[model samples]
Target chain A: MPKNTLGEHLRQQGMSRRSFLKFCSLLASGMALSPALVPRIAQALEATRRPSVIWLSFQECTGCTESLTRSHTPTVEGLIFDAISLDYHHTLQAASGHAAEAAREEAMKENFGQYILVVDGSIPLDNPGFSTIAGISNLDMLKETAKGAAAIVAVGTCAAFGGLPKANPNPTGAVPVSDIITDKPIINVSGCPPIPVVITGVLAHILTFGGLPELDDLGRPAAFYGQSIHDRCYRRPFYEKGLFAETFDDEGAKKGWCLYKLGCKGPVTFNACATTKWNEGTSFPIESGHGCIGCSEPDFWDFGGFYEALSRPTGQTGKNAVYGVAAGTAVGAAVWAMNRAKKEEAVRGHEKLTMDELNREGEES
Target chain B: MTSTEFLLWVKGTGFTLAIAVFAAGIVLRLAEIWSLGRKPDLAEAKGNANTAGVRTIFNRFIPDKGIWDRSAFIIIAAWFFHVGLFVVIFFFVPHILLIDSIIGLQWPGLPTPIVDAFAVITMVGLLAMLFHRITQPVKKYLSTFEDYLVWAVTFLPLLTGYLAYHRLLFSPDMLLAMHILSVELLLVLLPFTKLSHSFTFLLARWYNGAISGFRGVQS
Candidate 1:
């Protein structure tokens, strides 16, 4: 068996090479690309040596790493480690303390301007006093490390858009990496946990293309964040019929009615959750009967309170939404009232004119 | 017939009727547009009789203005909700399932949560719209008898759907029955009531847009 080959690796794990190829084909097609593109992808991947990757953790819960590295997680652990020569990661490295730090420095020096820098959390801008890696402030460490990187992949919403840390009255004044670094190309892999395939998919694209794939206006890959979740939801029929799940665990929810009324940010949000999905495309938050929090977008936290239905959010986002409903009703009524008044006024004017005309006719007769 | 079979039959009939009315309403609205200028002299533009101001309001629709005034939430949000709602309904999971089973076209289902959230947004937006009908000034003037009934008719099914899902306010089965009945009523009344706006709006929008475009007026 060929060593370090993708097909052979699949076979060693009791998986068929055919199944892996089919999955690649599926993924390719899901991005609205031709299945024919698979062979080229396979060839590029087969020929290229394992690219160096450095996974950096900053002020985060390690959820993004866990999301990417766990076995049971989608785009599983086997796929991630097998795909990249993950030289130095704070969480997955075998080195301890200074050794781990040395390993990262060594990796950067060896793979200068070649390694992919995957940062998974926000960096504190508040005096850089809030966070440090290896005793160096996160800001200093990020700049020092990122200076030689070929591309930076900001994984998770926190790293991409400052996630919850940048929410109202931000305490740490945490900011996304895009705020500081301006030279290198950066891609935002945004989600609360940042879906697994999205992380790996970015790697796969980078490996295959030898650079970043096209990104949207917001720096998210268009292949992943091109469409709104609303455009591909299952319960859309229910919405057209004006059916909705007003509360959690409602009958409409069980029946899979639309959740737009429940403060779902799917409409304003652009993401691939509805299409690519989590859990191997089996289901997503909306499919599981929860409304979207617009987690993938920038400043999602400030849109409105999370967990409150879109209809009833106390904040401006929700207030504006309610205002929309009320305005629709009021304008609809006012149009009718105006129509009715116009009709009545027309009738009165016609009657008075008829009386005057009748008197003239009588005099003439 | 057994209740299940009978219910299916009723649903089938209701769908047929909804489509029928939907089609007829389109035709009538088209006829209305066609006849707008039946008399050349009577159909003059509001500003200049020589100029045909068919562009009046409809041009704001159809291809769309992309974005409009911030204060136009009722119209703008309504457009999103209505456009989004129909796209979801006609092109969503269960609808596809129903269509495939009834008519034999098995398309794919939309992703779950997206459609789910869209429904909730539509309802909230619609309800707020109803409140606006009862509350606001200019909108109140524009409302009609059918508009009020349209609001109630559509809201019942949405509310019942929530009720059936949670078994809140009503038991599951009862809420289910209410939901079905409300949908059936909505369909039956669709063409007759202002609820016809769902279908008519598209034609109305297009006509306004095309005519406005023709007249070289800003929509």
Candidate 2:
């Protein structure tokens, strides 16, 4: 969504408050919060608290911020964080240079061990020379800022699992946030640039529950990453019946059958996309007629192509044909059925005729 | 009215419930697989195409070079039982009759002698499996009540099918009903049991074989 609110900007361009409130309700649900949480979310918006936040964008595309801003709220993006002040965001904050650096310093001291440190990309630790922000290396800035932060949220896959930058031949030696801060509790919300609602949902979870949701072995929240998308995918029924989409544009694909043969990793990749959805709960990559890229898992980028063969092809490529043996088996089975039927028919026919003859003899006598 | 119909209804129902019982058996088997065999951590490294686990196992499972290698006889026997059961169900006279009016196949069946022979052969093979399960020490250790239940459930259909066809020990009607009912019970139990593995075997086999394939080794 590119972090552009259709609010005052929308109002200036002409949008009604009624339409805006409806949009707010939509946003509330997008974050997967109960409708009851709406009033509190609204109240937080009406009485914006200005919670201090230090947004550190490292080796990233700024897509996370872009997604967050694109939320179709009634300026809810600005309003939600209005309760919490976003002290420094490289892309959003107008101020730069010594003034920008000065604001970060003051905010850190004021919210010491209390501020939310939102990190968007991986830190280059190989030489600390790979990525530098405002004269300080990303590695140094992260360490320094995280020293007394209340929470650290690794925003993108880069900061979550060292992402693409750490893929093969990774010269920069990028590392996820968990690798750096041993003392603090860090929430790694991974994705190429994770779904916008997931980002805010994590924030709301922290705000409402006062503790992180149960996490999986990979440290992803079990609420979202617990079940394999494949297990619950709508195409599962088709797979059970052996209906599969051989190609992206085929008839079976149009009918929404399984994409397993075309290398859909939904079978193994665990995520909420199938249920929670993307594009404002509109459609995810799989529903859009393309296979999942397994973007939610670590090292997904380096894992190779989306259409690459599955881990096992044992049953593919005529391996199951059983050829002479399979044909022989089928023929034998068919013959067996045929013979059983014929024998039963002949025996029953003979017995019926014999009984009739005996009855005839009894009648004549 | 036909031998195949009774077998289909028998097996269709039995194999189905066998699925549920099969599921439990698989979970129990997994417990043993975990304890008995060397298992690599599939979590850290996925069973992807480029990985060691999936690739190494694919060769043994996907190829046809070993169908009759004595050890392969067990698998061949398994296949025979499966094929025999399936043909008896789908291509059987009764099932055909049930759908014939709609699908319009109108195919004919084999004579009585051949049907009797197949019934006897199927029963024999099924007995061998039942015996093999009882005698194999490792399999015995892994066996559970559900496993025995599955074997019995599988065997009953074949027995009842033969009896129903022969009309040897009981009235065909009574024998046929018993056969059909037992098979139905098994079917209802399928999704909930290990017997479902009769179908899920492909998925599991593919999983293990794929892992081996990725590792560039035979399963």
Candidate 3:
């Protein structure tokens, strides 16, 4: 077994002690830990042996992997990947076919119940033929690989919430990892393509604390998904002030007004995109004059039209109102006719009697 | 279903159903009232009924000094509740967007914080009115189950909207769904209950003022 502490790996890569400490502090802050915990994180990560990470891709676009690897070199995410033993990855691994499968099998056996299993896409339960790696079905491979994992990391919205594949009229019957795996501690890092730092930040927390971080209601790390994107967005002031962009190039848009009027789902979406940002803290979707599509939330695709305002209905409400008016008018006219008939009946039934008739009736009695 | 899915349902199908019911009920009730035509006046006209009716619609917004002095608490609470409800509903950005979608009429909205303050005031005012109804002997005696039901339905939207805005008591999506659901309930119930006063009060005030004006008397 190859045994190397992360400290030794970093040192060999020419990362100085000061730089490593800085990285630790950065990681600590990103995880929302106090400054006081920096030393403990540094010590734990330095002394800890590299953990084996088996990356499994099933029914995914390579976007989540690209999100992590595409970061500028020497960034914290790249460094963390360098510090771990990545035994098998379809995209990044040098091995091919049998060799890659062999490496995965060996890693699972060598580090049984110790390796971290990172899943990037959803699992197809409909048919084994739908998604396969080396002729092994995604479901079969997942069930096999998940048996020995210390903890599972569902890396993107696909793996977390059965993203596009599980959208309306889902053909492949794709489902999230949690739908199948019920016995392990699964940490969901949900986004269309999760922010790179957030991906690394979660791994770092595990590396330093040797346990999963606090999770929110959806099994997402609370540190990143605790607050809503709208709450932390820089454009929040515009929302509060009621300045909204009516169109793509309107005055409000030019003035950096809130995109709420443009179908922004920021109010309902919870993610670190607004604060942690993308492209290395450069900008997120909302900052670029576009509304949030709520990529992080479950069933986002089926919620409604992406360009439709969150406050607006997805169906033909106007048509419904028109029909309602027609129906109401019909009912009203009928009721009116009935009431008029009743009144006319009462008038027709009215009887008049004179004092002479009453005197005659009294004499007869 | 997930909270997001629940939210979508309320915003979509549920909203459509509520608006349809509201529109139909209003039309039916109005038709029923208008069908009951008033008796024609045989006496000579002493005043212009049309002018008096239009004037009374605006004038009835404020009560006479005698009535105001006798029911100051009820008046103040009711006014605050009404004004607050109006501001929060029409001046809030999200609500404006909703209305604009339906009617194609857009308007600028007050700042969110200002609307939020109005929501709080609305809730407080509603609570005060409810308390008065329960505590005051005459009010308690006169009140029916419909009165309390209307009070609850009216107050729920304000409460839920406030909670959703602050993201309190539940997840953001869930709270927002609850808020929309509450509003939909109010719409569905409005036409059936005395809450129809929102529309009927106009006709009622006009009728009263027109009658008084026709007799050359102040109403």
Best model number under TM-score = 3
What is the i-RMS of every prediction? 17.4, 20.8, 1.0
> Per-residue lDDT for A1-365 in model 1, tens only?
12365544555677666766766675565445678899887677656666788888888888888777652444433564676778778888888789999988888898898888999889989868788877889889899889889899999999998888877688998999999999999999998887677777788788666878889767889888876676677776676576767677779777888886566766546778887677656788998888888888776776545554432213232233344345444544555566667667876887445788889999998
DockQ of each two-chain model: 0.03, 0.02, 0.80
Q: Which ten-residue region of model 2 chain A has the weakest summed lDDT?
A: A312-321
Ranked by lDDT from best down, the candidates are 3, 1, 2
Docking class of 1: incorrect
DockQ, candidate no. 3 = 0.80
State each model's CA lDDT, in order.
0.68, 0.65, 0.90
Q: Provide candidate 2's TM-score on chain A.
A: 0.73
Task: Judge candidate 1 at residue B189 and give its lDDT.
Answer: 75
Ten-residue segment with the worst summed lDDT in candidate 1 chain B?
B1-10
For model 3, residues B59-105, the per-residue Cα lDDT tens digits are 99998999999999989989999999999999998898888878788
Query: B1-219 in candidate 1: lDDT tens per residue?
Result: 322223333344444444444444444444444434322333444443223334434444544344444346677567666765665566555455444433356555555456666667778778767776778888799888877888888777766655644346642323444566677678667766666666666656555555554555654
Q: Taking the tens digit of each residue's C-alpha lDDT, what string does model 2 give over B117-166? A: 66666677777777788888987898999988887887887787777655
Off by over 4 Å in 3: A11-16, A126-128, A354-356, A359-365, B39-47, B214-217
Q: After superposition, how far is residue A244 of candidate 3 from its true place, in Å?
A: 2.0
Scored on chain A only, each candidate's TM-score is 0.78, 0.73, 0.91
Residue-wise C-alpha lDDT for candidate 3, range A84-129, written one tens digit per residue = 7899998999999999999999999999999999999999898889
Which model, 2 or 3, shows the larger TM-score?
3
